[model samples]
Target: MTANGTGINGVNGAAPAQAHQAYQYSKEPLGNPRPIRIVVIGCGVSGIAAVKMFKDRFHNLPVELALYERNKSVGEPGSRTVTQGNPYFSRVYVGAPELYEYFKGRADAYGVPDYVRLEHKVTDVSWNEKMGQYGLKIEDLATGKTITDHAEVVINSTGILNAWKWPDIPGIHTFKGTLLHSANYDTSADLDGKVIATFITPELALDLAPKGRDTVYSREEQDKWAEDPEEFLKFRKRATHILNTGFEVIVKDSKEQKETLAMIKKQMEKRLSKKKELIPKLIPDFALGCRRFTPGDGYLEALCEDNVTVRITDIKEIVPDGVITSDGEKVELDALICATGFNTGYLGVSVAKFPNYFMTTGPAAPAAHGTFIPCIEAYIKYAFDAVERLMREGIKSICVKEEAVADFQEHKDNIVHDFVWTSTCRSWYKNGTVDGKVWGPWPGSGPHFLESLAHPRWEDYDFKYRTGNRFQYLGNGRTIRELEGGDLSWFIKKGPKHTREELTPSTVSINGL
Candidate 1:
């Protein structure tokens, strides 16, 4: 996950005119400055990306970067954390296995181990106004020691899924059965030939249930799907069709919603034809795409198994042997799995009240609508751009403007109304908000988010200069290459340049008007 090359011109090539104007306020040169201290919390994909971005962009500069992970390894104790033992989970490109490999490779290639501190959990983060920096208190989980550190910049990449909450059910402790959350679940060996009952909504139930034994793709088939462009494209097209249809059903008219449901019913009927009676109990009554769409796979088929059962009734209590439902029915079960979803209230990128303290993958992040890798890549680029500005301008602190945040929230609120996430359904996107505020899902397409992140809105930030003068960063008006006696004629070298294309309206008559 490399940056999309949007900030290269601002950093390496000529600065844009707006940037020049922003620098014009600087009064003095940034002479012999101290190394910028940056602390990144969490060693997941986003945190690793932050480390990689800082290293790639400012390796030669005076920058001290530190990364801390609470888990024993880089990725961690969550379901998405892929260790060597479990190399695969989820089919998305940014799934655990792929991300673990990608970030780990980059970390090794860039020698990031020198700055990485595994098993170090950031316990608290607070602003030290007196020191004009962020104070971080970290607990060394392995050594049982506390460490205090200060940083000019702090990045929180502890993703939303880090904190897992179990469903609130009475007498849960009394249950003698093997109970576990989906996050702790790995292989299905324990579930084999057992009476299993999962407490989950329709979306998650469909995702976890085994579709059918034959539906499992062979290694060679999966390899072919990855290797062949045409096959991949066909798969993408089908997926896109389904996603688009789901979106239409949620946002469009009742008629279209009914038609889409009928279509889905037909497909479900074909898959679970033998257990037709279970269709009404398993399928959702709400509109499609109202909540996140979980791939059904062989879920319908699994429910049809004689030993397994799908219970949509609410759980009243957990008994010694099984679960008691709202209808006073006690179902005997050897195992109880809680497949309830994660807390999504905090889903987008956010700046803590303190300046220069930023977090990623929180509410309103573009990952809600697209592949997470690209979205994380975009955020890294955006965050680094701000950091670069701070370094170049001799700025002491930079914080997001209140108006900018308010405006962004307003825009997000308005856009979700046009999407299915605004429908009357309880989901992670809604974050339990009664007002129907969508905390997840980007308002636009993936590419749109990428384009939007191409440049940071510099005006949307308030900066404090080291010298108490904003123009202090306009450093002697000399490039680093020129100052260091490097190749001065490099700009004269032949290269492809951006040329403006002029557009003219066609003069042809329209329908002989």
Candidate 2:
């Protein structure tokens, strides 16, 4: 469709011939901004940051907000959305408890808890055409009752890691040993002298003690960071710069990818010196960055223990004793842990029919790389900018054009194969399909993603006005900004700079010609 398909004219996509119905407005003054009710789902990192933005960063806007989180407390029940690591931390690794405390503290600091509805789950949402708002069906988990609510805007941040999945192995539930899924692990389970099998990281299958774990900050270093803010800022900048610019590393044959492949192979081989036979099984043949990679401080050494047995073959069945391999061997164990990863499909979810809202950190976003917080913050800012326009202007509904989304999808798909995620490795980014669509990340670098979203394409959206006469929002020939004592002449600017001779002798030059 062409750009003129927005149907911006009067009723029936046609303009009036004359002053139809005498302007259809009373010419009242455009007073203070209208109140907008915004509902945010999931209180993970995205939800917390969104709340902070609404409550603290955008206090001036007339916004009514509510945050719905499924978890009753800060941490528990699937661990929600914490993932990956950052370099700027005092240590490279961060635990779930620390992240939970950090978000909890922010919730208290900004008084976000006041607007949070804990233990509430949003089951369904649809547009209420009559009321010009969104209708939501919510489930109160504690009461087992469904409730109904309405909001002008809904921001879904439920995150992708909430759903834990198990491998589709036959007779999986027939095992007699204590079975565990990493996402829903039981902390009280005892494994002191019993054999354990793991389908994920090797360290989880054994009691092999790590030789050394030094991912903590020294006393002096911590003191220095506390004493000098500049040092901290410098370190943060350096780390963020590296993270923001490392997008090229995922390119299939890029120099960075080759270097990373060599480095990872060297690290793994050195750690597995005693058991060289396991190297071929553990080391992946595909290029690096095709899947999520971490430093894994002590994971390699833990796998080198004498008692540890690493299996890479496909599972045939889950016998009463243990897992049966395709090669006809049954490995006995007292416990089994399945770190089979999450059902990450929700991370990049998109619903075409839904209106008056958009996803943050969604598919085709730069979220798959870099420090995720920056990406989350950027997306929130972008989403709220639309929310501001909807509240400030007399807009009934606004959503991206179908053609625009199609174009974006086609463009992203054209360039996605250049990255490592589309290589010969199975990844959650592709929903575990080796050749499936890549939807979890932007096709460019982190900075490029930020810059592109900094300026929203207002024309790419279809905006429906609240009034019959589109110009009714002009209202009394006075704007809210002007009423708030802003500079009335702000739109006026000096003309282009001209030479003195050209400005003074225009008449003489005409006469001579």
Candidate 3:
């Protein structure tokens, strides 16, 4: 059959007509001929991952990528605290160093090390709409030199925990004892002979008040996990299952909550049997799992020492020698430790005024539940995918629609109401907000968040392309493979076949037919 002088089927067929008349092959090279600039702030895991993704995916493309780190090293911001041998509070399922090494190794493998600028902080980010680029003011801490740089895109990987906030107790500086925040807490060696008093809220107090046992894995087991993939998968499945049980209890039903509370109480009772009087002060009156649970592991036992004391009362002020309680009772101490916590609600992403800016560990990130590495990986993928789309389309600028953000926040707010994190309890998750806003938790399963981020809706973004027309990205009626003398019928080449057969309708289930 012939239509419009083109044959539908036969050994020979006429070429298809051009779809648009305005399409002129400008005689210029196709595929982003101009260089694309990308600047990533914060050299943490998220930033490193972003850099690696961009390098791996767009190596052939003309792209310029730079990573700025405020600290002296890549993992200095958060890893400094972890390097002190204080095992991560959450169940990481893998060694902390192993994860750090993975990120660093990937960065090195992708040639990211050469592009990183250490001790260079991004003080300000301003977009020049006239030039369709972002201008950043960077300050080098070591040399004390300030410079201005421009980029087509910017990624903010500054973690939420970067900002540490101290509790506002009066006369805290008056204490003659050594004072330090938990973020700067190096070792327990100095507290060997000194009277050390660590001030913490009820949420943290519960975790530290109980003397729990640490799960120590043998070096052989670690080697086995590293060498044997199947063994590691099995171990991960079991660990995740155990962690999910707590999530279910806190977010789903109260029966499990009561049971878990009773079990914890029994354990605490047995552990502190000799000092039963401390149980009432240690066990919180609120529901269990309302806040992030830390495996105390020997913390309560340390408090039972003759020189140690777990003061339950609030601090009224800091006296010359020690802390003064709310009841005006003085507790003599040689050192004070603030286990207070970091500030939240800073979504490292772009503000309404700034467009084409993205953040990884922002307030909207899913952090309250599950391991953070996976969440960081998901967010990185989401942001980088958008960047890739921008580059492919030759888009000058793109910003997430306000409606999309609002919809996401609304969904988060609705789902968090069912979780224990929304319960009436003070914690870092809320960031001292009394409006009942839960900022930390993702309000969904880790897998759910990962899956949702896998496919970002392009419609939720407003784009500005190189050409005025949005459909200019449709490009000439030809592809790179066609221009490069590649196989035109490559799509028809078959390679491998699956063992399972495709699904077919059964003859027995033909009633509808």
In model 2, state the lDDT of residue 144: 91
TM-score of each: 0.78, 0.85, 0.81
Model 3, position 279, has a per-residue lDDT of 73
Tens digits of per-residue lDDT for model 2 on 89-114? Answer: 44555544445666677678867778
**How many residue pairs clash in all the candidates, one count each?**
14, 0, 2
Candidates in order have lDDT scores of 0.65, 0.70, 0.66
In terms of lDDT, model 1 sits at 0.65
Off by over 4 Å in 1: 1-34, 76-112, 186-189, 211-250, 254-262, 432-436, 476-479, 493-513
Best-fitting candidate, measured by lDDT? Answer: 2
- What are the root-mean-square deviations of the candidates from the true structure over C-alphas? 9.1, 6.5, 9.9
- What TM-score number comes out for model 3? 0.81
Superposed by TM-score, candidate 1 places the C-alpha of residue 42 at a distance from the truth, in angstroms, of 1.4
By TM-score: ranked, best first: 2, 3, 1
Model 2 clashes, total count: 0
Give residue 367's lDDT in candidate 1 (0 to 100).
47
- The 10-residue segment of model 2 with minimum total lDDT is 1-10
What digit string (tens of lDDT, one per residue) describes model 3 on residues 401-440?
Answer: 5667788788878887877777777766788653367776
Higher-ranked by TM-score: 1 or 2: 2
